[model samples]
Target: MKDKLKKLIIIPAYNESECIEKTIENIQKNAKDFDYIIINDCSTDNTREICERNGFHIINLPVNLGIGGAVQTGYIYGIRCGYDMAVQVDGDGQHDAAFLQKMAECLEETGADMVIGSRFIEKQGFQSTGARRIGIRFFTWLIRLMTGKTVTDPTSGLRMVNRKVMAKFAKDYPKDYPEPETAVTVLHCGMKIKEIPVVMKERAGGVSSISMQKSVYYMVKVSMAIIIERMRRRK
Candidate 1:
């Protein structure tokens, strides 16, 4: 039965006990055909226990790996486990489980290497803070300049990647502000990428890991990193 499940949901959780259960339940209800793996990134809360108790497939990280590491771990796991595709969803409950099947279908039907769940494609939610929104727009333009495709929501955490991409990312993935940079990387590698309109909701619990002060740093740091990465690739 597990062999028949082609798509897997890779959720990276960090102190997400409050919402992880509900998120998992929703995914189970809405996307039953897909299996799920929760990468417990050294969460201080009861996230791991909750996942275990709920009979979810979980990988417990001994140390705290940030979002990028945790997600990449899931991708690696999915690739090794012979899954056809892996979709990344936030454990914070921001992502819509209902859209998983649609995204997976698009990935399979279009033969795209990556399918990004974009909030801005249809402009259907409180996307982000003012500064973050501006930052996302700027990064979107930057990614387009590099990739020759306009990605309206470059920072969206919800995305689906095929096994080929999973192999690539497992080998090398961006650590800081990975979402935007990864889209450019995938494009640079000559892989097909697509965006679909997906409605995102507000976090059901816990505060954001990215604070206002850190948001500024995130923008500048990620911009420089992307430029450097691009230049290196050119050489």
Candidate 2:
């Protein structure tokens, strides 16, 4: 790992106490070389206690920042710590650590600023709910039509990025459903992006923050955000 660029895994947890340990264990077993930071987003559960007792490296936020803020904090830390690359993985144990190496390799070999671990690239694994799948397809078509880049899993949380992208994201990142809109920013900045086939499992514990009602709001918000991003000048 030292021979290559130093990599950091950023796992953001809200109330993922039940699965955080297993998620870390998976990373330790499958990708031991990379370092990791768990952003405890002011969780009400024992997520912070588990991290403390286990001596896991973590940033205990003073407030309950949403997923975007937690992940951006990780990128900021990565830049400050001189990490050459950073990967965002959920703390709910849905993301597979085994795919981290492949994403890193894609980033290095293709010189892409970011490589998204996608479930739809090969049409395998949990394909999400019917309503969410419709939103994903709409965003996929929107991104392709706007940037001419086909991103099958724009909503995927598992993604890896080089230092250049880390710096950009650390400075400014969306605080909501950001994966799709952030991809627009990457393209507008003349950065390259790629997606690789990866399998994702269902969450190990705790309910997803996005309820069925919130899913409708998420789709509308992200769709509008991506459109507004397209109209903006390149940064």
- Clash counts per candidate, in order, are 0, 0
Alpha carbon lDDT of each predicted model: 0.88, 0.92
Query: Per-residue lDDT for 122 in model 2?
Result: 87
TM-score of each: 0.95, 0.97
Candidate 1 lDDT by residue in tens digits, 1-235:
4336588899999999999988988898999889899999999988988888878889999999898899999989988889888999999999989998888888878989999999998888868778778888999889878767888899999999988999998998876569988888888778899899999999999778789879888888888877887887899
CA lDDT, candidate 1, residue 57:
82
- The prediction achieving the highest lDDT against the true structure is 2
The C-alpha RMSD of each candidate to the native structure, in angstroms, is: 1.9, 1.4
- Per-residue lDDT for 1-235 in model 2, tens only? 5456899999999999999999999999998779999999999999999999999999999999899999999999999999999999999989999999999889998999999999997878888888888888999999998888988999999999999999999999999788999998898788999999999998999779889889888988988888888887534
Candidate 2 structure lDDT: 0.92
What is candidate 2's CA lDDT for residue 68?
A: 92
- Give me the runs in candidate 2 sitting further than 4 Å from their true place: none
